[model samples]
Target: MARVVVDVMLKSEILDPQGKAVERAADRLGYSTIASVRQGKRFELQVDGPVDDAALASIHELAESLLANTVIEDFTVRVEDN
Candidate 1:
């Protein structure tokens, strides 16, 4: 079995309205030192493999295909010995 970790984040140019809204509210509450806040997603998975380069490539494809939207989001992949 192989373990995979995926981190998903929003594109920088895309407006993070959620973060902006939160920052405005916090400032109103006297937390103005905070400049920004971004929300992201992290996912973990287990797969069967002898765990070679092919397996790793397939995992990346799966992440791009189902978990991440290539246009507005970016993703990083990590593999761990398990």
Candidate 2:
């Protein structure tokens, strides 16, 4: 078995309203060090594979096709062997 980790995030050029909301809250809490904030998604799945390069590619394709919308977001995938 292999474990796959996927990180989904909006493109930097896209405006992140939720992130802005968090930034607003941070500012309210007097956190001056936080210059910006962006919300993202994280997903981990156990895939049936030997954890090779091709298996990793399949995981990436699965994430791109079903897990995330590419119009405004990007995804990165990684696989680990068990």
Candidate 3:
């Protein structure tokens, strides 16, 4: 089996209300060193077979299409060795 990780996040141009809220809360809690915050998602996928070029390509496509909003977000996918 192979493990794949997908990280999805909002583009820099997009405003993140949730992240800002978290940042504010953290600041109020005395974590003043935090300059900013951005929220994102991580997905772990376990493939039942070998991870090859085609599999990687497919995973990339999946991340671009389903796992992230290309118009406002960016994403990266990588295979993790077990």
Give the winner by TM-score: 3
Candidate 3: what lDDT? 0.94
Tens-digit per-residue lDDT, 9-66, candidate 2: 9999999999999999999999999999999999989876477788877788888898
Q: How close is candidate 2 to the true structure, as a TM-score?
A: 0.87
lDDT of residue 75 for candidate 1: 94
What does candidate 1 score on TM? 0.75
Ranking by TM-score: 3, 2, 1
Tell me each candidate's RMSD, in Å, in order. 2.4, 1.7, 0.7
> Per-candidate TM vs. native?
0.75, 0.87, 0.95
lDDT of 3 by residue, 20-60 (tens): 99999999999999999999999999987889999999999
- Give model 3 RMSD, 1 decimal: 0.7
Q: lDDT: which is higher, 2 or 3?
A: 3
State residue 64's C-alpha deviation in candidate 3, in Å: 1.2
What does candidate 1's lDDT look like per residue over 1-82, in tens digits?
A: 7788889888888888887888888889999799888777899988775667887788799889988998999999998766
Winner on TM-score between 1 and 3 is 3
Q: Per-prediction count of colliding residue pairs? A: 0, 0, 0
